[model samples]
Target chain A: MNERLTYESLIAAKLEQLAPLPALADDIWARISADLDREMPTDESEAPSGGGPSLPGTGGMLWPGLGALLLAVAGLLYWYSQRSGIPVPAPSPQSVPADARPASSLPADTGSPKGIYQQPAAVARPVEAMPVPLADSAAAPSTGKLPPPVLPLPDDSRPQPAASASQEPPPGQPPATAGDKASPPPAIDTPIKKKPRGVTGISNNDYRIVPDKKDSARKKN
Target chain B: MNTPDEDIQLIIDGCIANSRKAQELLYRQFYGFAMTVAMRYSRDEMDAADILSHAFVKVFKSIQQYDAARGSFHAWLKRIVVNEGLDHIKARNRFDSPAELDQAEEVPVDHTVVEQMSAGDILQLVQKLPPATHAVFVMYAVEGYNHREIAERLNISEGTSKWHLSEARKTLQQLLQSHR
Candidate 1:
């Protein structure tokens, strides 16, 4: 009995008794025929140039615009190159002065003292000029030495005779150098210590300028 | 001078040649069969008509692909019409949820019960099932497809197809019992 209720029998019976579909189907067929007729080309010659029409903005026009953009970019690059100055070449090692070599180029000390004090004495001469007046003042310290005389020197010292120029002092002013004395001290006997101008890390006495080691030692303590 | 097969061949040949007269004749001749296929899958006359037209257009475009060696032209065209109608229903996405079948349990239907119900009543009741289940049931039962064939056509599993058909039968039985 369950087998008798098969899906096949039901469908077969339905197919046999199904109502006709003429009017609905005819309307459908008419519409399809009409649409096909409308869409089909009227003349073979008027059919689209190719099998199918292409999408807009995808063909010839796009290529030309892209090419023009590339040309414009290349032209801009050329213009920028022309307006800038020619590039200068970098200097080679041979072009640099001996003295101008970087500090790192100096030989390492390696704890040796051979050239440790090789800095020139001409660099130390300025220290002597500062102490000349101090020596004079110390000699007269008991009298509370008068303030050093301020005298303006002539700009044309090059033309003056050396001997007479050495003998004269500014009016009512004491000699700053011994040349103004009735009997000047022998030039060689004076011990002049020239302070090196522009050289830091040294005192006025021309000492070998060591760092303040005492302060660092106290900090450690 | 004309066997039915020869007559159908002549109509088909005319249609291939873009003969409007032959197309009109063919449309009239198959209108009943195509409409039955459409009506079974559609909700109303207008919808059925639209499905029929679309199916015919597809048939015209793909007529060259059809081989008489494979099956009868009517069978081939009927397959196309059914597919188009199913596609239309799917595009509309008008299936009911399967939750309604919760109360639908399978019953033992005897030959007497099957005999009492008309084909129209059974089809109407089949149509009332959820869309996915109804499609599977029609393709499997009415169209005489195996589970694998129905599964391939509908893009569902063979198990799913069997389940849908089972649920369809249960629902159909319940509807028939109520009608009685």
Candidate 2:
């Protein structure tokens, strides 16, 4: 114990020997007892065997599953629109202001002698810039309903019924004047549904049922 | 491998069972050592008392986690008290920056200075150093922690830890000479 008091070891040894404040022991023990009582958990249901509340489990998975399903639906919608070559509409058309729409999306004002040619949008490309053309401008009836003959366009892939362009001028060229006369309408763009190979020979008669065996003999051809 | 006192063992068993008398007994038995550890790390008696109280609460709650494989109950309790001291320092932001470390002469004080002064006087001089330097001195010298361990615990560089310890030694020497 009679070692030289070097600065390194001196402070450590001195600090250890120094006594703390009087009654610090009593004060600390009082506080510890109070804390122990407060932390003891009065209600049995409120406490777990491990001395804490158990984490809620069943409710956690539902939201993630719902979110995944929503994500998958959104992905399917995006994929279908991409596959079908359809121009998906804005998420909320009514919520957006007219001025907010892009320049290309807006249609131009047209006032020619031929008048407005409104085409059915189902079989047509949804290009808002291209005006509809009449199938036969001269032969067009002044009044009464007439379904414009939707002819098939020359396409290597799916057989699409396109607007007949015989009466109208080819697209992207100069607009034809009344003196130039109207050309035939262009071919339509409808996708023709092809019958699958497996169900080709099945007739509708196979689905039809006779009321009874004698009832089939009484039926007229 | 010193055997524990029968009374201490009985008190510990009672503490584990949440007996109030046993807990109080345990607290009274170790409060001096705990207080000493706390006071050494703290600036004032009040802060020391606070750190001591906090350590006891922790010791009581986590006493179950302590095992014979680790070390003696006293050592385990000392570890908790030291940790509480560190926490107190951290919470108060008591550790001053290295830039604030005082520049003291490298020359050692007279050999008889410590013999002439009480241990309290020396500790008071230690407390006079920047909190950061004091903590390093206590941890490295008293607690036997290396600079690397000090750096890891205090979230500082090893160089910084070394600087604090060096600065602490210098200040203590100067304080010793001044006290004489």
TM-score, candidate 1, is 0.49
Global CA lDDT computed for model 1:
0.59
lDDT of each: 0.59, 0.61
List candidate 2 stretches off by more than 4 Å: A1-5, A41-221, B1-4, B94-107
lDDT of 2 at B125: 74
Tens digits of per-residue lDDT for model 1, B86-165: 89867866444434322223455544555677766666676788878778767766776777786687666666666776
Estimate, for each residue in B1-180, the C-alpha lDDT of model 2 and write its tens digit: 435666777788877777767788898888777888888888878888888878887887877787866788889999898898888887766544545223322456675777667778876777897777778778877788876787788887766776777677677777777787
Residue B167 lDDT in candidate 1:
79
Location of the lowest summed lDDT over 10 successive residues in candidate 1 chain A: A146-155
| Model 1 misplaced regions, further than 4 Å | A1-8, A41-221, B94-106
lDDT of 1 by residue, A75-135 (tens): 8866644433122222221222222222222322334443343322222222212234333
The Cα error of candidate 2 at residue B21, in Å, is: 1.6
